[model samples]
Target: MGAIYTLGNAAANRLSLLLLTLISAEVLDVDSFGVFSLFLMSVASIASISAFGGAATINSVVSKFYMRSKDLASSVLTMSMLMSVFVSLFLSALFSPAIYDIANASGAYEFVFIYFLLFILSLLMAVFSSLEGAVYALKMAKGLLAFSLLGLLLSVASSYFLGAIYGVYGAIASIFIHRLYIALSAGRLAIGKTGLHVSVGSVKRNKEFALMAFRRLSFPIAAASVLAAPAVTLALYILGKREGVASVAEFSIVYQCFVVAIFPAGAIGQYLIAKSKGVLSEAVNVRVQAAKYLFVYGVVAFLGFWVAAIIASHYFHGKYEISISSFLLMGGAASIYCINCSYSSFWSSLGYAWPIFYSQIFMAGSILLCSLTLGETSLEIGFLLGSVSQIGVNIVLLRLTVHEKVAL
Candidate 1:
């Protein structure tokens, strides 16, 4: 799941960065950029809450019931479906105001205010996530990868072409369709042969499981601040408030490369959940497989991204520019986080929810303070530093959970 998602994510992020960079320069004026920037920030932030952040727990529990209980898939599916609908409604409400404000600030068309409805994309994602959980439950990582890649392609092609044709509004249209495609395709599959279903009683019963799952995931989710929120905050800090939006947009594009890196490893972690419990029993095969994949992720990431960055810098021109140091450091930091994320899954498998859940302190600070502290003169440094705390927290948590010999 991680590898495939990473590839798809990389392609999409690169495309988005390229497209947005151009739009930031040629399409959006400074005020427009500010408005667009706010929308960008809200998309990530609201989606997290909107989804109710339940996918991982869904992943863990669904995996357990599917592989072990077999009879529980329908119940898990049912719970997922219900949660998806609830999350969408909740997130749509949360994001609507932000969209309105951003659009009002942009002073574009009145329809720009309607951009807040994009939260529907997030809500719809909750639905897709439920379906994804069903896929995860079935250990259908490859199928999930295909489903994700399809949506990614749709998003990439549509957004790029649409943005070029209709500016940000066109981009918005692409987003609407993207959500629809993902929800329909993945949702149908899970509900089809698998009979993935959800219910209210199951939601009540699984609340504890869900909470623990959230507790375990807080580190990773918070760690992600380095990519979007902190990056935006740091840009605003360093670049003078005037340049904040543009700088945020720029580094966001660059940092997305790191986010893309997580996909493949993430896919692997998702696949491993079914047998994750087997690790504690000194399952040599599982441990060995984990070790082998970790090494593979590292080697591929190191080699692949370095080359891509070089090409992006030398050939892409204007838009993809990054200083040599920033590029390398960013990639290295991303690589570190990737490995940590993989181990965090192992910790999760151990029933410990890895990174020892210490990231709570770091996540908040990283966003508000660490990012805010970066002066425009130090934007790159800020991007590199913010994720460090997340990486550190995960490392410690993984150590606490995994057997040393496990090579996590």
Candidate 2:
């Protein structure tokens, strides 16, 4: 039930996102859409920094601590929220120059203000979503889905209406509105259920879990800042430089489809991570089952997406002009990514967070190398390379989990 609710909600939300993108692309000019796409991608990447994996960290920490003391759980929640807002402000200021440069290059310099708004909004959403993860950790799937879908629905309605009238400004406003709803509503549910409230005393007392979470948090942010986020951003920049902004728009659409395909695996991974408890052998079995499920589902999803890509290419060919072949490659990439996510969830649940960080570094490096050398001609190839690199990294992580003795 948890898996179905989670996956179903994610799919609905992503579909709304896809629709929002399509409407933005249709209403705004290609150049504007390109800028919007970059902003969205930037949000995803920078969110890792602002969020610092706080959601996952809080989820892991709260799940364990709640059993012993709800106050500790609440303290972690407060600390996470505080940390998210602070990091959002800090990182937004830090990245202002880079944001301006990208905006100028995309021929949308004026949109930088909107970009910053969206960036900060992304931070808030990421931080609050960590609470959502906590809710999921407690197996309250339906409640999580309700708030999530409500946010998406509101976002889509506002974004579409505003984009038609205000163009880029309206589009971003829609995003901000959507994220704000999620942040507030989900935060409330998470806090009420987990007994989360601001307590300065509790914050100072719960030092151990905070430190552990911080240690786990450092790796993903480093990986994102250095490798994962930068690599994708660079690839998009390269594609824009070589082919034009329309290329960015095209590939962004393909990536959105990939997002839809991998979401189910991610949903299952979340369920497994939350439910995974007991002895080492039990954890091992959970990992094994996760791998098996992803393998089976990835294959099935690939075929479905491949077919859907063909149909979408035929329908959207005149307006979007996306290559069927490129869309097919994205489907393949999404398939591999599902299994990768499964491994990621399994390891994180077991308290071996370093492997995910290491693997992301490898994946980023591979994408950078491949995009610079081979992807000058085709963005699809760059994405394929990224997928391959991610799979390779997942394999390494899995091997380490199997062979080495970790005291999780």
Candidate 3:
């Protein structure tokens, strides 16, 4: 399982580089690239919204209920599908204007909608796909990684071929197809392995549990999405406004790579959490474990990214405006932010939503300021500042969490 997880992470990072290279070589232009980035960022953040913490919800509840009835998790997933749909539609409508602008930049109006629709769809599928968190919760990282890697290959290949021919639209369609395959394949396979079935009757019996999940998950995940809003806006305002299409693509390349720490840190942390629940039920200790892993994953993933980016950055040619010093600075800072994501997991795992909400809002707001006002020098600096802000929040949260426990 561990090895498989490692493989999946490697695949994910590799796909990022592959996408960057292909975009640089083929359809990516400066203004067009920035628009692509904006869509990608929005899609990612919105994906989280649609997820509504369903993976965690499934992980937490399935363990508790399946002891009584094995089919319990699958039934709840049916309801989760409904909730995800609600969130996805709400967000699409809420941000349609912003989404429209991003698509217009690429001169692909239909694509903008297609990207958002697919983004929401893939995200929705991911939730159903996450019902397999039970598989993960049960320590089947092998299966988890296998399905994910397959999906990644399909996604990368699809985007490359389709994008070359149809431009950004084709690339997005490929992603849609790839994720669609993963979502379906993983969900069906998990059901077979778990021997679970989804029935409306069983879900009806578990109505209270589903509602409870919504209560706990919706706001917190929404808040996390909100916290990221500033960074997206900063990207749009400074890079979209200043750098144009080509610059946008390069920035997207760099930014996405920098954010890769989110996955490996999440992979290790979630695997541990899934295994440790109930058996290791101390909130204080959970916080400590989270903080420690945050640092460990951050350091390792950070270094790996720096080397990869240095190697890949040269391949993109004149697409970027980043200097060596700025790259190093942002790279280091993003490493720390990845660490912060781990601590965030602690709060999220514990279902302590308000603190997570407030903290992220504060962090994102601070990043927006630096990016918009101080952005004239370079986009890398803005990204660096954003990373620093997140790291600062994590450090404070860690100290406060530990100190409060010690006093008790």
lDDT (C-alpha, whole model) for all candidates: 0.54, 0.70, 0.60
TM-score of each: 0.75, 0.89, 0.83
For 265-350, candidate 1 gives per-residue lDDT tens digits of: 65556556555643565333454576567667766776666776676676546643456665666666566555555555565565
Model 2 agreement with the true structure over 1-408: per-residue lDDT tens digits: 888887876676677667777778778877778877877777766676666666566667667777788777777666766666776666665555554555564545544664567567767666766776777766666886887777767867887799999987688777777767776776677776556666767878986766666676534644554567657877777767777777787778777777778877877776776777424666667877777888888898789777877767775667677766877777777778787876777666766667777767766766666666774325566556666777787776666667764322
Candidate 2 residue pairs in backbone clash: 55-130
Instruction: Give model 1's TM-score versus the native structure.
Output: 0.75
- Model 3, residue pairs in steric clash: 29-245, 29-246, 30-244, 30-245, 30-246, 30-247, 31-244, 31-245, 31-246, 32-245
- The worst-scoring run of ten residues by lDDT in candidate 1 lies at 218-227
- The digit string of per-residue lDDT tens for model 3 on 43-87 reads 666666676666666666665666676667666666666667776
Model 1 residue 146 CA deviation in Å: 4.0
Question: RMSD for each model, in Å, please?
Answer: 4.9, 3.1, 3.6
Off by over 4 Å in 3: 1-27, 102-129, 197-200, 229-234, 278-290, 377-408
